[model samples]
Target: MAGGMFIFSAVDTQAKFLTDTLHPFQIVWFRQLGLVLGLVFMLSYHGASILRTAAPGLQVLRGAVAAGSATLFIFAVSYVPLADAVAVTFVAPFMVTLMGALILREPVGMRRWTAVIIGFLATLIIIRPGTGAIHPAAFLVILAAALFAVRQIVSRALAGSDNTMTTVAYTALVSVALLSVPLPFVWQWPTEGWQIALLISMALMAALAETLVIKALELAQAVVVAPLHYTILIWSTFYGWLIFGDLPDLWTWVGAAIITATGIYTLNRERLAARKPPQT
Candidate 1:
């Protein structure tokens, strides 16, 4: 899963590259459109049965938030370094912790909450609020992470009711709808071979990366799966340096390490807390 996640950064980098040639809306649209095709094939085995009683509203809400989150994240990556844009996404794990306590009424012990706060502190390290090093575009990533957290919360609510396949399918349909709405304003033909290559690159990576993520989760515990979060920093850093000639500053690394540590600790703590002290 970690390895798969490392490849996922390619989607971010490629989307940012393509954003120079295509709108985030168009890039996102192609991504979801490709995913929708992949999802249809996966759902073929289930026939119409997969359409049973999952919470459609929550699913659609998640789709919209994910659409917006992805759109904003890509938009920010165009202005910020790839690694820096990705570092700000560390906010999602922390926000998910808070959302679980507030929205799901899940019991969170003091230690876990402290870890959450520390995680946010890490995000601040990257942004450096008082300094001008942070781009205003960074806020877009922050908001994206926040909405993504809410989407994850909604996922928890609907977990057993829908399989991962159903969620993936919903993502395809709804994100496509969400991303397509702005096509009229941003649509343009690819006039250059480089532009065509960029779109194809973005869509292909987005489809493969997301599909592999779903597969990765099936093979491991979500908590066990969480550490893959840090792999994004590693991959993003490479892409930032190699493709864009942008290297993250010290604060970005500091924040990423802190956030990665806190996120890991919190996941372990949550797993420990979920235990029910074995039935007598």
Candidate 2:
């Protein structure tokens, strides 16, 4: 998960850099192209069977949600600071917990519920609606986070029916296809060699990050690895400072700390619940 987060941060860094010259939609489409190419290479040995899934509808839905999430996030990052954008997206875990309770009918204790509330409040601290600290674009990150939570929910539903590679492949294919629909209107081909290289790197990093995440989840318990996602804030802050000369303010860090702590707590609670034996 840590490796995956770092790679994703790199992808975000590239996307932010490309935003200077390309539209978010174009950047997103290019990122998906890398994912598709990477998946093709990674699964080449497995042959076409690797793409087969019993839940094609659900897979397509998940891919569409992922496309929406990616587009919104890229758009948000184009305007918002990387650290701020990342911090706000951390709210997805809390949203996932809520959705699990309401949609999955999973048991969520009061303690976890408290953590959820605290997590959201922490997000507000970062956004601070009435204050000037918040960017109007930050809300796009929040919306993206919500869609990401939906993706997680759908993923949980698909877990029993499909392998990891199948999920990843379908997502790449679907997202690329969906995002391509707007290419004619917003597409801008790179004029410089460095721009082309950056776009390719962005795609490769995005694909690599997704694969690493899938492997991490396969190797470790979700609760154990999920907390590592907070590491993205550190990487994002570093990249933002080093590459863009943007540092998150004191309040951003404070809110991010609160959100991270509560998110970890929430995941820990869920892990503990899973360990408990079923009630009669």
Candidate 3:
């Protein structure tokens, strides 16, 4: 998961760079291109049966949410500092925790709820709403985070009924299809060789990161894997400085620290709960 997060940071950095020349819609389409190719490979290997799903509606919904989330995120990063954009998105796990308890009937105790509340406060600190420290585009990241949480919830629901490949294939197909609608209007052919390279590299990295994250989730509990996302902040900060010569100010760091602390605390609570024997 940590490795995947690192690659994800790289992918975001590359997407931000490409945004200077290409539309977010076009960049995301190319980003999804790698996954579409992987989907083709999966289909060939597993044959048409791989696409079969008991929850077609959920699959389609997840795909649509996935498309929206990816586009929103790419669009957000194009405008805001990458670390700030990513920091705001840290709200996603809190959303997932809340949704899991409320919608999926998963048990969430008071301690986790407290952590979730604190996490929101941390987000407020980063965004500094009335002060307008961050761009309006930051709100788009929040919307993206919400959609991402929905995707995860839908994934959890489908876990029992659908194969992982099926879920991934649907996301790739739906995102590519959705983004294709604007391609003709927004598309700009890469004039330089480096632009072409970055586009392909972004796609390959996205596909690889997707695979690693899926494998990590399969091996560990979501709570255990959740905290690893904070590592992206580290990579984002590094890449933001090294590549873009951008850095989050002191308040952003402070808020990110608080969010990380609360997230780790919440994860610890989950781990303890998982270890406890079932009650009579």
Candidate 4:
């Protein structure tokens, strides 16, 4: 997860820089293109059976949601500082916890509920809507985080029906297809050689990061490694400072700390809950 987060941060940094020249939609489409093509090659060489999924409709829906979440975050980062955008996105885990209670009918204790509320309030501290401290586009990060939560919910639902690779492959293919619809309209092919190189580099790095993260989850309990998700904030801050000369203000740091604390507490609670013996 650590390696994945660092690479993912680099991918996002590249995407944000590309947004200066390319539309977010186009940037994301290109990012997914490499994965899609690789998946297609594997399918062709192996067999069509490799693409089989028990829940095709859900897979497609997940892909669409994933595409929207990625695009919105990339778009938001174009206006919101990288660290601010990443800090706001930490709300996704809390949203997932809230959605698990509401949508999955999972029981959420009062303490976890309070933590969720505080997590969102901490988000407001980062964005500070009324104060105009951050761009309105920051709200898009919240919307993106909500969509990300939805993706997690769908993944949980599909866990029994599909393996991780099937879901990932479908997401890549579907995202490429969906984004292609708007590609022609917003598309501006990279004008310089470096821009083209960054596009390919971003796509490869994203695929690598996704693989590392999945592998990490496979080897470690989610609760044990979940805290590593916050490490992206560190990388994002470094990249933001080194590349854009931007840093999160005092309030952003404070908000991030509260959110991280609440998230870690919630995860620790979950770990404890899982350890409890089954009721008679």
Best by lDDT: 2
Give lDDT tens digits, candidate 1, residues 8-108. 78878778888776787887787667677776777687776665546899778878887888888888887888899888888787787788889778788
Prediction 4 TM-score vs. true: 0.94
Which of the two candidates, 1 or 2, achieves a greater lDDT against the reference? Answer: 2
Q: For model 3, how many clashes? A: 0
Best by TM-score, which number?
2
**TM-score against native, each model:** 0.91, 0.96, 0.94, 0.94
Reference-based lDDT, residue 267, model 3: 78
Q: Name every residue pair that clashes in candidate 4.
A: none
The local distance difference test score of each candidate is 0.79, 0.90, 0.89, 0.87
Error of model 2, residue 23, in angstroms:
0.6
Candidate 3 lDDT over 220-275, as tens digits, reads 77778878988999999999999999999999999998988997898788789889
Residue 33, candidate 2: alpha-carbon lDDT = 91
Q: Identify the runs in model 1 with alpha carbons over 4 angstroms from their true place.
A: 43-53, 278-280
Residue 62 CA error for candidate 4 (Å)? 1.8
Which residue pairs does candidate 1 place in steric collision?
A: none
Q: Could you tell me which 10 consecutive residues in candidate 4 have the lowest summed lDDT?
A: 213-222
Order of candidate numbers by TM-score, starting with the best: 2, 4, 3, 1
Candidate 4 per-residue lDDT over residues 147-266, each given as its tens digit:
987876676667677766777788888888999998889978678999999999999888777657656665666667778999999999999999999999999999999999999998
